[model samples]
Target: MKLVVAYIRHEAFEPIRLELLELGFPSITIIEVKGSGRQKGITEQYRGSALTNYLRPKIKIECVVADGDTQTIVDTILKHARTGSIGDGKVFVIPVEQAYRIRTGESGEETLQIHPDAAAAAT
Candidate 1:
């Protein structure tokens, strides 16, 4: 299995989410995160005071899928998230040793599948 983690601009979340759903990948974990990359951070003016090196707000989207789906998921995120600008974000693909669904006790690749019938069966 592979875990795909994408750090994207806040504005890109909705589009990327919709695209992922359309691509048959609806199970995702989203987190609000703050960090800096090559752009190092940005400076902003707040109440006539310059705020330097402020961490930018980003949406972290995490999905665990079968290894074969890694590239497709990454491409889907990129297709919807890229804005042709700096701070667009980054995607990291990591190996997942295992995954478990607490309610159904599904594990591994089965935990990543989205078939309603399979879910019902698991229960």
Candidate 2:
């Protein structure tokens, strides 16, 4: 399985989540986060004065899915999150050695029962 981590602009969270659900990725975790990229935060004008922007608010969406669905998931996130500007955010994929559904004691890929084809496609 692969873990897809997406850090996106806060405003785009709801839209991205809806898009993900439409693409069959509904089991996800969303969290509020703060960070900056190459541009390093941003500067804004307040009351006719420039205010230093050190950290920006962002949303982090995480989900584990079948490897075969990796490309689709990434594409979906990028398509929905792009703003044609800086701080649109980024996506990261990592291998997940294990997972578990605490309620049922289901483990590993079984935890991600949402994607039924993951195991079959893995081999």
Candidate 3:
């Protein structure tokens, strides 16, 4: 298993989501977050004054998928999230030791999938 975490601009969320769903990987977690990277934030003007906000908002997308799906998920995020802008955000892949589904006590990849019929219906 692997964990794919991506911090992306708000504008890219919907497209990225749809792409993942169509790819049959719909299990994901979304979080609204604030942070900054090499872009170092942006400067804005208010009341004839300049204000710099170091933290920008990003939507964090987290997915625990099968190891084989890691690359595809990252590629999908890149395809949808890029805007050629500084604050476009980042993607990280991490090793996952294990995973579980409390309801059925299912573990590993079994817990990360949707029934084929259900997945197709969703798309």
Candidate 4:
């Protein structure tokens, strides 16, 4: 299994989620995060005054999927999250050692069976 972690522009969350669902990769967890890369955060203008904020608001989306589904999910996130500018965010795919559903005691692949997309798609 692979764990896909993506830090994306806050505004791109909805589209990414919808696209992931359409691509049959819907199981995900999202969190509000703040961080920066090369360009760092950005400047904001308020009341005719400009303020530089180094920590930008971003959305972190995490999903665990079969190894084969890694690329597709990464591409989907990149496609929708790109803004042709710095600080667009990044995606990381990590190997998942194991997983288990606490409620049902389902482990490994069975843990993912509860995911509608994973269950519907015959990967």
lDDT of each: 0.89, 0.84, 0.92, 0.86
- Model 2 lDDT, residue 50, Cα: 90
Please rank every candidate by lDDT, starting with the best: 3, 1, 4, 2
lDDT of 2 by residue, 1-95 (tens): 99999999888888778988888788899999888787595679999999878788889999899888889889888988999898889899999
Model 3 residue runs over 4 Å out of place are 115-123
User: Which of 1 and 2 is ahead in TM-score?
Assistant: 1
Positional deviation of residue 57's Cα in model 1 after best superposition, in angstroms:
0.4
Q: How well does model 3 score by local distance difference test? A: 0.92
Q: Encode model 3's per-residue lDDT on 1-123: one tens digit a residue.
A: 999999999999999999999998889999999998988958999999999999999999999999999999999999999989788899999999988878777788888887555669979
TM-score of each: 0.86, 0.82, 0.90, 0.83
Ten-residue segment with the worst summed lDDT in candidate 1?
A: 113-122
Best model number under TM-score: 3
What's the CA error at residue 118 for candidate 4, in Å? 12
Q: Candidate 3 — worst ten consecutive residues by lDDT sum?
A: 110-119
Among these predicted structures, which one has the highest lDDT?
3
